[model samples]
Target chain A: MKSKAKDLTDEELHQIVEKAKAKDNRALGRLCEHFYSKIYRFIYYRVNSIEDAEDLTSEVCLRVVKSLPEQKGLFYAWIFRIASNMITDYYRRRAVRSNVTSTGDLIEEMVDEKRTTGELLEQQELRQAIKHLTEEQQQVIVLKFIEGYDTDEVADLVGKSAGAVRAIQFRALTVLRNMYVRKDGKS
Target chain B: MEQNIELLLDNCIDEIRKGKSIDECLADYPQYEDVLKPLLQLAVQIENLPQPNPSSEALSSALINLGKEMERNTAAAEISEAIVPSQRDVLPQKGFAASMKKRKTFSFFSEGSFRNVFRKSKLAWALSTFLFFAVVLSAVTVSANSVPGDILYPLKLATEKVKFFLTFDSYGKAELRLNFSDKRLNELVEVLQQSKTLDTSLLKDMLDEAKLALEENEIPVEKASILTAKLNHVNAYQKTVLENIRPEVQATDRKIVDDAINVCDMRSRWMRRMMNEEYQEQYDEQDTTPQSQTPNRKRHQPKRMQWGEGCDWMR
Candidate 1:
């Protein structure tokens, strides 16, 4: 739960939720002033598309409304978890539709069309290296290295022991190292 | 021969992640200086790239949508509440009372008993069946577009709220958070129970809270299992009590994930199941661990993490 203040604190977005509970229209309008943009940028970076980012962002808002009266958690992670699930589900469904071909493979092939050659190569390597990792390892690594969450948050996001997250991180890095050397890039 | 700094690899990864020059990090950890320098440099080169950040407009726009959604929900609630008492007058005057008032006309349509039954039977039954088929077909068609995307749950404060629109893809899936109050959690348990994906820790937390309210409020035992069975995952947002929900939900989630495995089992295709099982087992395993078991790793890695350069980093 967020702390209450006489005047709404900067983080006092919950004020909107409270007013919303009482069926207050203006308070809900105030909430719209607060969270929409942050959620959009987060989705933009994660999915890397302007259109998809907008859809996921809107979906997140709709979800927040229908489920607001019932949700519990800090504002950011609560929403981020929702966004992550949405993205993961999207990938899973896509993977299914594309005849079982890995999204990572699709990422590599699409890299040239989507980004500069330098980033293209970098993302390509990341795509290849990620495939070699266990899915858990990949998720933690994505949340940590790619998504900019710290170790503690990554553990929270994945619902695992920090030690387990660490060990997975260790293994993930080792796999990348192997892939790097195996390609003779470092050799 | 080069030194293996497996112990130092962890910190080195952190250093690499932080965008520090490998040489700088090498000097920071003097004890592993010799062992970690090369691995550190290689990792630094690889992981030095910038992380992505969302644009400034994203959060603001999401908040506005939330406000719109809340206003809409509140209006809907109010409108529904205002109309409940008047519903009787709203229905058509074609029921038993109307039939009695028009009894004289009724006999003209059916004076001969069985003749009355046969009067409009064909027409009425035809109309009823046609209406039913139309409804069923429309419902199926309307429901076809519905997936997990419909009815996103938002977080409303038990008391005002804090919250979103995230991103849109070509498919443009909207993201919503599920927020529930203590009492609402009980109701949610029922809903989630049907889908079998409710967050069990929440069920348990709701149970405990419901228990606390026992002196003032009674909680049925059946509600507890109903709560527990429907939980699929836990959220970061929490009530004043039971902040430890993440691990609890994960523990439960790990179990429900097996349903997918059961699906895999249903395939009867040995190759697909075997491969999926291999992946599923690892995630299913992570789904359950004690809450306290998380967040204890030392920030320092034994060595810097290098991809493509030192698969030997582990060695």
Candidate 2:
């Protein structure tokens, strides 16, 4: 669905979203398919397990489909907000926020054929370092960088001001840079 | 200010997303390049982190589940719509939440509406069950006082039949039947008192029940005395009651009344015979005198009244 989503213009995407809001199943399927990879990646990077990300992604999609009719604002914001909430609920239910990203599991998640092992290891380190940031900082980094959502959009999804989102992004990046420097120095 | 540099870093990241080189933007803010470059490069690398696609199996399964849920919801909405047409306009505006709320509020007669409807129906069923028992109890109560032609009189008869069958012991059954016979006589009197035409069949039934009570097979000897005494008393009362009502009967029904009196008379004779036999047996057992001198046992005999004198003989 995300593959199909890449080829479609903004207008076509908007039409599909509108049809989904009207309970058109085909359009809803397209919408879910389009966001599936993105939502999965968003959850996967934040959570420790691939299964958890897949489950949370599906949950977020279903909630979006059900609540679409009553949705009043931007669809992206609404959907990401649902995904964010699902992740929070997952952690709350588990009662422990474990960041156990084994190299074997990270290697399995590498879908890109051209990515070198060094890049993969770097990405893994980035993911591990991201977990050490505050919850708000992690959300800001994931929303702002990984999802490529603008400051205002990230702020809307996370229920904060644009200025706050910007500050969080900066602090999150600074912390990550420090972690990378320390790791390099230790090596 | 630290806040300014944060804003500037965000501005540079926005430029990088828009295709401006990160190094070109860092050059513009030359003084903060050292602090901002690593952060910007890390941000770019994090953004470059490979996005994972959901497995096709999981995606399709999730989609199928979503479709099924939507179908169920649509079906529910259609049923809810059919039940309450006025709320149709509200469903589209407020969606499933509003439709469900409307259903709870207005779907009184819908079979599949809300849990509360089932609860209300259960309460109704309980109330109806209570009402049914109450009606039966009231009918039995009313039937207790009903005469032959009253609406509830059949109920009274059925109740008596139930009581008769429920009595397991033969003596108890006979007693109950005899009591029923007495009730019939009372009803006959009540009919006469009200000047209603007496049902002759009812009178016959009463006599038949009395005969059955006195003629039950192999009554125990111990209970026989008590049963015989009760029969004698009932027969006397029946004869007196029959005689008392004879003048009140119309000329055409007088024959049936006479027949009833005759049955009462026969019952009295049979009772007297039984008593005589019993006394004779006792005398035979107690006799210590010679058999030739037994004729003198007339001195021990109790005085008996003549049967021709009617109920006065029984008293």
Candidate 3:
């Protein structure tokens, strides 16, 4: 049922893109509703603050609206590309301010109320481990596993070939497995 | 071996994610179970990790804000379109010589087949002429009231450049430039009076232009006197305007305002001296106290002098 619903949205995406390009506010609103949670989740995992994630998500939506007229190609890939660039810029600015390269440190500073102490600790460990991966590897893992993008969709998004994406995913997962075992041994 | 195992594991994970049991997926890749089992299990765990989702309230608020922004952009565009025709209609027709010169300039560009084509159709010629002048005039009038920080300020300066180009005489050009300088001062005063922050750089540019005009010494004495009088009139309100703006004025801007006031005073004094000299000559020529002959003259003299003195006191 979930896959069917996902397929339904995927089919409607083309019409949604057309209406949004025509500046139909209702269509844009629907697009925002459909993508907001996914975009927010993507940003939140990297930035680790609900407030910053929400703000960045809003910025992404605004950019989508502004650039929709000139944008072509797959809507999903195009929208996520905007998201990816905005996140990179956000971190670059943050790095300039704090003189730090690790976003995981910033994530640990956030006050998340949704998770218990153990869950937060575990999530933090996961985030830190992911942060240690190369940026491409991290993007692959996030897009493939968390956001549930298929291999080809991930390839189109990250501008890599399918084989490259698969390789990146494999490497990222292997790194996570090693890190998970090491952390389990420590605990 | 490594590449083959990686592909098999990748396929197994895809099947497992699509709702096939781990047992079923491994059955097809039993040779690589040692490599696939832990990797697939880790992938499953990672996929099930808690991720952040935007609250519904945040989503609704963002959508509302985006709607407001879109509405603002639409309204602004509509207002600009509505303003264009009315602005064109209000522009005063150009004088004959100015219009002819403009036509000559256009003809200069309309060389080759373009000129013949333009001349062939009387209606097209008339339409193009009207459009040309209308666009030029509308831009000027619309930009006239634009303050320094406004988007139209550059257009306002460009219109002044066009005026300079159209003026035939040197002194006329100087006078026009001086008037633009005065216009800037007035805009500054108006903005200051409204308790809005003035663009200090524009104020400085205006003062510099005024000073440059005075130093050029090309303006006729009578015309210079008129300009000086206008400056003095503007300066009269400067004190009140400055008082309103004092708290907001930074050190750099305060210096600019002070320099502008000083320039106004210096010009006013010179103009007053020139006027008194002219009055003395006229009185000498009359050889009698003509106060009885020109009753209004006696009253105007004191009033004009008093206005100059008011500016002096403010300085």
Candidate 4:
């Protein structure tokens, strides 16, 4: 379906959000349709499984439908915040259930079914490198590079200063480069 | 040293995102080339990394789930709206100036001045109080015999609802509901007698509500006996009406009519028996009175008691 929200300007997006707050099902449906792929993609990158990503994406949409009336910030930020929290909770629950300590072990449990053999190996290596970084560093890198958010947007989402976000990204890139070099040397 | 490099790297990345080569970007800042080169290369690699795209199946599934959630929310909102209409529905939709004028006119009553006049003048207060009750009593009396087709029928229903609202205890509410149920049957009978088309659904709903009230067993046997007498009256009318319209009524409506008639028959017979037991006890009490004191009156009393016993069915 063509998303009514995708073509909407900022003012039009705000209008749709207002209509959604008034319980307009059509507007809410449009918003859900527009945001579903983005949210699912973000969750897929984090969880590495289509099924889990689909489930969490629906959960985020449900929360958005419920909390949209009370929300008082940028719509994208609010939505991403909910997705981020859900991802955190998912990991927390999985960690508790499996009692696993290593991030590689967690990633191993969530193999991407879509990738070919070589692509899967490269992705696994990339995820392994990302998993070694601190959680804050990983978030900055994902938001800036993967999600294509600006420094200020990343700062706002991560609750850090813009400069701090840049610093995190710089350090994250340096560490990731070293890890890639090491992996190449080993090979 | 680190802050300048971070700033320079941020600028370099911005330039790269805007379509600048690493060599061109480094040409402007050769001093930081060695440090910036690897980092910029990694940035480009990260940017080019294979980000996962949600499958079409996943997207469609999430949309379906979201649609269901929105539907559930809309249904809940509709139900709430039906139960309690919003302020916009209840209040007048006049402009602000009109509302302000109304507020001004009512301001005297809202403040203590009008209340003080009523408080200070005893006769004025008493007269106002009497007028209020008189108007209410007259409205209720005028609306008492109003049937479904009558203009006063809505008023009658509203009055009954007010009574239902005022009655606190479960048994009281049940009895009132039963009374309203009897009224519904009376309305149905009136419509039939006038040869007007009857509202079978309304009658059915009222009968169902009445049955629910009786099944609750909230009222005492004595109180229920009165309802039983009313039910018998309804039963007699329902039977007569059903017999008159049996050929003309649709099959579906006939079933509803039949169920109502059956309920009336069952409940009325039970109530008659209960009333008989009660009246019999009363007759026994009167029988113990001395026959020597008034012999002629005592002889006639048993006949009178028997007549009263049969009269319960008529009621």
- Top lDDT prediction, candidate number: 2
lDDT of 1 by residue, B195-247 (tens): 65645444443433322221221223323222222221211122212332223
Q: Which stretches of candidate 4 lie over 4 Å from their true place?
A: A1-8, A96-116, B83-315
TM-score for the B chain of model 4: 0.39
**lDDT comparison, 2 vs 3, better candidate:** 2
Q: State the lDDT of candidate 4 residue by residue for A59-178, as single tens digits.
A: 999899889889987787788889989988998888832212345533544564544667656666776577567768878877777777778878887778988988998899888888
How close to the true structure is residue B81 of candidate 3, measured as C-alpha lDDT? 44
Q: Which pairs of residues have clashing backbones in candidate 3?
A: none
Q: lDDT (CA) for every model shown?
A: 0.46, 0.73, 0.65, 0.66
Ranking the candidates on DockQ from highest down gives 2, 4, 3, 1
> DockQ of candidates 1 onward, in order?
0.10, 0.24, 0.17, 0.20
Task: Assess every candidate by TM-score.
Answer: 0.38, 0.51, 0.50, 0.50
**All models, RMSD in angstroms:** 41.8, 18.3, 23.5, 24.2
lDDT value, residue B213 of candidate 4: 59
The true-versus-predicted C-alpha distance at residue A64 of model 4, in Å, is 0.8
Q: Give the runs in model 3 whose Cα sits over 4 Å from its true position.
A: A1-8, A96-116, A185-187, B83-315
- Deviation in Å, model 3, residue B276 alpha carbon: 63
Q: lDDT value for candidate 4?
A: 0.66
For candidate 4, list the clashing residue pairs, or say none: none
